[model samples]
Target: MASFLSAFSMFGMSSLGYRTGFGALFVLSVNLVPLGALWYYMHRKTFVLGRARSWMSMGMPFGERYGNGMRAVIPVVVLLASIPYLVAQVQGIGLMVEALSEKAIPYHMGMFFVPVFISLYLIMGGMKGAAWVNTVQGIFFSIMVFILFFAVMAKNGGFAPTMQMVFDTHPELFQLGAKGGKLWSYPMVFGFAAAMCLGCICFPQPYMHAYSSRTVKGFKTMLLSFGGICLVIITMPTLVGIAATVIVPGLKGVQADKVYGIVASMALPDWLAALAVAGGFTAAMSTVNGLVFGNATNLANDLLKLMVPHVGQKGLVSAARWSVAVIMAICVVIAWNPNTPVAELSVLAFGTVAVTIFPLWGAYFWKRSTAAGAMASTIVGFGINIVMFIWGGKNMVLFPSAKLFQLNGFLAAFIAAGLVFFIVCLVTKPGKIEQKSLALFFHPALDGKLDHNLVDRSENEYVKV
Candidate 1:
C-alpha cells in the first residue's frame, strides 16, 4: 500500500498539491480515524479470524452475517471501483516511460510491458510473490521520494526560499481552502477523509494482507508502521507539488499531471531524471501487482468458488491466474488513452465506493444490520455516485476534494447509503445463517469454538474475546 503513495499518487498529489497546496496531506490521515475504530470494535469482532482460520476470503464476514447477495456484490463493487484506479497506476507508468525515453518507446506501447511481468510472477508465486516484490519496491520509492524532494528544493535554492517564493507570489495557496473552493475547502477535505476511511473497508487488498498475519500484535504493529511510512512518502510529494508552481507554472488540466516528471527532468541531471522515471515505474508496478492480484483473488476465491461448487483446488488456482490476465487486459485497454487526471481517477474511485462502508460498518458494529440492508446500500451508494459521474460530465467537482455548496458527491453518497442501511436493518431481523454467523463473531473465544471455518491445521490458539 505504500506504493499507493508512489507513481500515480506522486503524479496525482504533485498536480493536486499545485492546486490544493497543503490540503492534499489530508489523504494520509486514515490512521487517526480508522485506527481508533478498529481498536475499540473490529479487533474484538474478528481479528483472530484472519490467522489461517477461515474459508472466508475478502468480505466473507458480510456473507456469513448477512447473505449471499453481499458475497456476490461487494467484490464486484470493489473491482469496478478499483479498475479506474488500476488504470490510473498503469497510465502513470506509461507517462513516465514515454517521458524518460523521450518518446522513444511511446505511451501506447510502454504501458503494456510492465503488467505482463507483474502478472507472470503473481501466477507462479501468488500472494507470497507479490509481498516480496512490494517489500523491495516500498524501500526503493521511499528513498527516491526524499531525493526528489531535495532535488526540487535545491533547484529553488533551499527549503526556506522555496516557501518564501510561494508566499510572495500566492500566500493564499498555503491555506487549506485554496483557490476559493475551486480546488479544496475544509468541508471537502473532511468529506474526502471520511470517504477514504470507509473505502478502505470495501477495498480487498488490505483485507488480503490481514490473512497473512500470524498474531494480533504483529498486525497492529504493521498497521501502526504504515502511518509513519505515509508521513514520509506523502510529505515530500506535497512539497514537490508546491515547488512546481514556481518551477513550471501556468499548467492546467492533464498538463498539471506532468509536473512531477517535467520538474524532475528540468531540475535533476539526465541520469538522475532517468532514475526518477524508473522510481515511478517501480512504484506503479508494485501497486499493479497488488491491485490485479487482489481483484483476481476476490473473483477466484470469493466469487468463483461460490458459483462453481464442484471446482477442485487445481481448478481454483487456474481460475485465479487466468482472471489476472483478463483483469489486466481490461484495465490496460481503458488506460491506453485516459483523459481524466491520474490522481483524480484514484481518489474518485476511493470516494465512490466509500458508501459501502454503511453496510460494512453495520455488519461488524451493529447487531441489527441485515443482509437486505447490506445489499440495498451497496448498490444504492454505488448507483448514486454513477449518476453524479454522468451528471458532472467532463468537469467533476468531487476530484481532489473539490466540492460545491459544501457537499461532496462522496459525502452525499455516504448520507444516502447510511440512511438506507439504518432503515433496512431496523426493519429486518437475522435468519438462521445470520444468527449462527453472529454467534461466531460475537463469541469471546472464536477459534477452536463456535462455527469457525478454520483450516484445522492451525497453530496459534485464540486468546479468547
Candidate 2:
C-alpha cells in the first residue's frame, strides 16, 4: 500500500498529466509491469526466506553473486534514493497545506510540522506502527479522493463534457506528436514508462516491506489488491488533471502543480475540501513514515552492523529510532527549498534506484553473474544519472530543441546500467554459485514439495559462504 503511494505523489501526478496530456497515461500504464514481476519473484521465495532478505541482512541472498562490496553498496543506494523520495512526500504535504490554508501556513512550516508528527509514531512502533498507519491512511486517501474526483467531474457536467472541453481546448493532449504544444515525444513517453515501471519495484522501501509478509498466499493477495489500488489512485489524478485543464485553463509552468488544490477548493464544499486535504495529508504522511523506517533500519542494521557490531538488539532499536528523527530532520531541511516539481523529483528518486535492477536481476537469475559487473553497473549507472541530472534539468539537453540528447535521465540511466551489467558480467570471472541459495531461485515453488533446508535457513551474520 505504501509502495502504491510512493509511485505517484497526488499533486505530482495531476500536474504531470495536466502538463503532458496523454503522454502521462502511457507512463502510468507501463509502470505496473514491474510490480507483477516483483510479485512473481517474491511469491516464489520459500516462505521462511521472506524474513531475512532486508537490505541489512541481504548477504545470504546476494552474497553468492554480488559479494560483500555490492551487498554493502545496496543500502547506501537505498538510503540516498529514499531521501529525495521522502522530500517529495514532504513537499506534497507543503503544497496541500498551503493550498488548504490559503497559503497562511507556508510550505516550509507545513513540511516541518508533518514530519514531526510522523516521526513520533514511527519512533514508537517501528514497522508495526507504519503498517497500521498505512492501512488507515490508504483507506482515507482512496475514499475521500474518490469522492472529490467524482464531484469534480459532476461540476463540469460529467466526464464526457469535461473531456470534450479538453479535446476542444487542448487537442494536442489526445494526439501523438507534439501537437497542442505538448513536450513529450513518443519515445520519451514509452521510455519513461519503462523507467517508472522498473523503478517502482527496485525501490528499497517496497523491497523492505516484502520481507514483512508472512505467507506467499498473503503476498499474492496483497499484490492483487495493490495493483487494483494503483489503478484507482493513478486514474483519479489523471482524470483530475484533464478536468482541471477544462475548469481552470491556462495553468502554466509550476502553476500546474496546483490543479488538485484548485479543483478541491473550487468544486467541493468546505467539509469536502477539508477531507481532501486530510486525505492528501495521510497519503504523504504514510509514505514518509515508511521511508524513514526503512532508511533508519538500514543504517542501524546494515551499515552500522560491520562498524558497531557490539550494539545489541536494544541498542540497535534505540539507534533506529534516533535515525528516524535525524533522517526526518534532514528531509525537512532539504524540502525547505522545494526546487523541483513533485512528480519529477519522484521520478528522479525512482531512476536513482532503478539502476540496481540489472545487477539485481543478474544476481537472482544468472549463474555466471560477477561481483565486478554488479559493482561497475551500480557505480556507472548512478554516476551517469547524477551527471545527466546536474547537466540537464529535465530534457537532458542544454538548449531547448537540441535533438542530439533528447532522452530523459530515467531512460538513459536504466539503459546504461543494464548494458554495463550485462557486458561486465560476460567478461569477468563467474561468481561462486551457492547451490543452497541457487536452489531457492531456480526452483522457487519446488512443485509444492518443500525443502526444509532452504525454507528453514537463517543467517546470523554476513559470511561469504
Candidate 3:
C-alpha cells in the first residue's frame, strides 16, 4: 500500500507541480477535491474490500475476471502503456544525477543503476519487500520535501514576498485558464482530475496494495494517510518549481523535467542538494519497483497461467522474477532514447488506465453497468486515445482537442458496453445455477472466508460451481 501511495505521489508531484506556484490555493483545491472524494468513498463503503473480493471471486485476483477476451485486452495495454511510464522514472534518476554531480556520473549510469537496485529488492522480496522499502523511502521523501520547501522560501523572502514576485514576473501562471489564464485550461484541468481519479482506482500498483494489506481497515488507513501526504509532497514541489522559474530565469533550453533538479542544485547547499537527490531517487525507485512488480504479477498469474495452467507455484514465482528483469531491461533501452517528456510520459499511463479499466470495473459493480457496456467503453475509450496520441504526435491537434474527441470515445464505449450487457442478461437470462454463482461471488456474506469451491474448480465449471 505504501508503494501504491508513492506511485501516486511521484506522478502527482511531477505532473501537477507546474500549476502549483501561481495559484497555490486553487491548485491545491483542484488536486485534493477528487482525492477527498475517493478517500471518503473508501472509508464509508469499504471500497477496497469489495473490489478485491470481486476480482478474487471471479477467478482473477490479478484482473482475469472480465473473461479471457477482456483479460487479454487489459494486461497487454497496461504493459505497453507502462513502458513509457517506467522510462520516465528512469530518466528522472538520470537527470537528477547529472544536475547534482555536474555530469560526473554519466546519464546512462544513473539510469542503469536505478533499475538494478529496483530489481534486486523486487526479485528477492517480491511485494512484501517492495512495500517495506517504500514505507521507509516515503518517510524520507516527505521530510526532504518539507526541508526543501522551507529552505527555498526562507532564501527567497518567505511566502508572501515570493508570491508577489511571481505575480509581477509571470502573472499568467496564476490563472487556471478558466478565467483568461493559461497554465491549465478549464477543460484540461477537469480532464486531468477525471483521469487521475480513474487512474487511482484502476492502477495496478494501487490494486496490488489493496490486495496486500493486512486488513481492509489497514488499506483504508493507508489510503487516507497516503492521500494527505501526496497533497503535501506535490504542493511543495510545485511551489519550488515556480520559484525556480523566477530565480533561475535562464532555464529556457533545459527540459521541464529538469526543473526540480535545477532548482535543488542551484538553490540549496551541498548537504541539502544531496538530500534532494536522495528524495528524487526515493520517488523514482518507489514507483519503479511497484510498476515492475505489477507487470510481473500480471505475467505470472494472468498471461502465464492462461498459456500454461500446469506451471507450479514455484515455477510461476520464478517466471515472475524473470519477467521483472526483462521488463526492466526493455524500459532501460527506451529510457536511453528519451522520446517523450516526463510530464507527457506520466500522463500517458494515467490516460490509459482512465480510458481502459476504470469504466470496465465501474460498471461491474454498479447495477446499471453491464459487462458489454464495460467492454465497449474500454475498446472505444482506448481506441480514441490512441488516435488522439497519434494525431498529437504529428502536431495536427493539441491534447485538448484530442481529449474532446476522446470523451466521446469513452461515452460511446461505456454506453455501448453497458447496453450490451443489459440486453444479454435479459435475453439469454442466467439459469438458477448461474444466479447462485453470481450471488456467492458478488454478495457473499462472509467477511474473510475463502470460497474454496470457487477457487478449486476450472474457470468454466466455477461459473456454476
Candidate 4:
C-alpha cells in the first residue's frame, strides 16, 4: 500500500517535473478553467454521494458475468497502452541520471537501474514492497520540489523580478490568445484537456487504487487530494521553466522537456541540483512502478485467468509478480531508442486508452448501452485511431504532424466510436441477456446483489444461441 501511494505521488509529480514555464503555463491555463468544477464534482461524487463505490463495484462485472470474451479484450489493450508509458518513464529516469551525474552514469545504465530495482522489490515483496519504496521516494520528491523552487527563485532575484523577466522575454506565453501569437493553439489546449480528463479516469494506476482502496469514499478522497497536489506540482515546474527562459534564453536546440534540468543545473547549488535530479528520478520510478504493476494485474487477472479458467488465486498472484519482471525488461528495451519526447509519449499512451476504452467503460451504467453495440463501437473507434495514426496526412496525424490538424487522434476516435454506438444501438436489437445484466449492474434496487436468475438466463440463452 505504501508503494502504491508512492507510485501515484511520483506519477503525479513527474507529470509536472518536465514542464517548462511555457508548457506549464499552457497546462495551467487549461486546467484552471475547469479545475474548480472537476474538484467539486469529485468531492460530491466520491465523498458526498458515494459514487466512487459504484465505480469500484463495476470493475469485475464483465469478468464475472459478461463471459470470457469481454474479459479477453482488456489485457491486450491494457498491455499495449502500458508498455510505451513504462518505456517513457524509464527514459525519464535515464535522462535525469545522465544530467545529474554529469555522464558518470550512462543513460543506458540508468535505464536499466529502474527496471532492475522495481523487479527486485516487486518480486520479493509483491505490491506491499513496491508501495513502501514509493512512499519513501514520494517524500524525497516533494522535498526536492520545494528545495528547487526556492533555490531557483533566489538565483533569479526572487518572484517579482522572475515574473517581470518572463513577461518581458516571453510575453506571448502569458497571453490568452489562440492563434499565431499564442504559445498554445486552441486545439492543442482542448486536446490536452480532453486527454488529461479521460486519462485520469482510464489510467490503470488510478484504477488499481480504485480497486485497492479501503472504501469508495477513501478512493475519491485520495484522487481529489492527488489531483490538487498535481496542480501545484505542475504549476511550480512551469514557473521554473518560465524562469529558465529568462535566465538561460539562448539554449539552442534543447527541447522543452529538458528545460527543467538545464535550469536546475545552471541556477542551483550542487546539493540542490543533486536533489532536483533525485526528485526527477523519483517521479519516473513512481510512474514506472504503477504502470508495470497495472500491466501485471491486467495480464494475470483479466487475461490469463480468463484464458485458463483453472488458474487458482495463489497461482494468479505468483504469475503477476513474474509478469511484472518480464514486462519491465521489455519496457527497458523500448526505452533504449531515446528519440521520442516525454510529453508526446505520455499523450500517445493516454490517447490510446481514452480512445479505445473510455467510452466502453462509461457505458457500464448507461442503460441504453448494448454489448454488441459497445463491441462494435470499440472496434471502430480503435480502428479509426490506428488508421489515422498510421496513414493520416502529415498535418492530420496525431503524434508528429507537419501541419497541426487541431484534432487529436483520440478526439477523432471518441467521436467516431460514440457515433457508431449510438447508430448501431438505434438500428439493431440488444440481447435479453445484455439487458438483464445491465439492469443487474446498474439498477439501484439490486442493492449489491448479483441477480443469479439473470445470470442463469444469460447462460441458457447463450447455450441456445
| Strongest candidate by TM-score | 1
Instruction: At residue 84, give the lDDT of candidate 3.
Output: 63
- lDDT of candidate 2 over 1-465, digit per residue (tens): 753574245778888878878767767766764566564564344233445444334333455345567767877776787777788778777876776788898877777767789889998877887889989898888887788889888997998988898899988777755445556666666666666666666665555555776555675666656655686677787788877887878877555766787788888998888888677778778878777777777677766765786889998899888898888888888888766767777777777778887776775567677788888998888888778768766556111233435556666677788898889888887645433446544544334433344444432211212
Best by lDDT: 1
* Tens digit per residue, CA lDDT, model 3, 1-465: 245433224433532454344443353456565664564353322233334343421125323223555555666667776776687788777766776677898787877878899999999997779888988887888788778777777777898887688789877767766455354655555555555555555557655654555554565566667656566666777777676667666443224556676667776898887887587678778878988788788777777777897999898899889999999999888888655556556656665655554434443343333344445556666665566567546122124544455332323333344455455544553334333334333443323333333223322333443
In order of listing, the candidates' clash counts read 1, 0, 5, 8
Per-residue alpha-carbon lDDT of model 4 for 1-465, expressed as tens digits?
A: 222222222322233323323544565556444544453342222221122233222224444324455556656665776665677677767766665677898888877878888787777876667667778877777777677777777886898898787778767656544556443566666776666556555556655554555544455455556655666665566566566666656543213445566677887777778778677677777667777777787778767776687999898889888898889878888878766556556666666666544334434545565666666776787677667767763124343233435576667777778788777767766566566555444544323322344333433443333
Candidate 4: which stretches are off by over 4 Å? Answer: 1-23, 29-59, 64-66, 181-183, 250-256, 356-363, 392-405, 445-465
Runs with alpha carbons beyond 4 Å of true place in candidate 2 = 46-48, 52-60, 63-65, 178-181, 397-406, 431-465
Overall lDDT per candidate, in order of appearance: 0.72, 0.70, 0.60, 0.59
**How does candidate 4 fare on TM-score?**
0.82
lDDT of 1: 0.72
Indicate the worst ten consecutive residues by lDDT in candidate 2. 456-465
The predictions' CA RMSDs to the true structure, in order, are: 3.9, 3.6, 5.3, 6.1
Give the lDDT ranking, best first.
1, 2, 3, 4
Pairs of colliding residues, candidate 1: 444-465
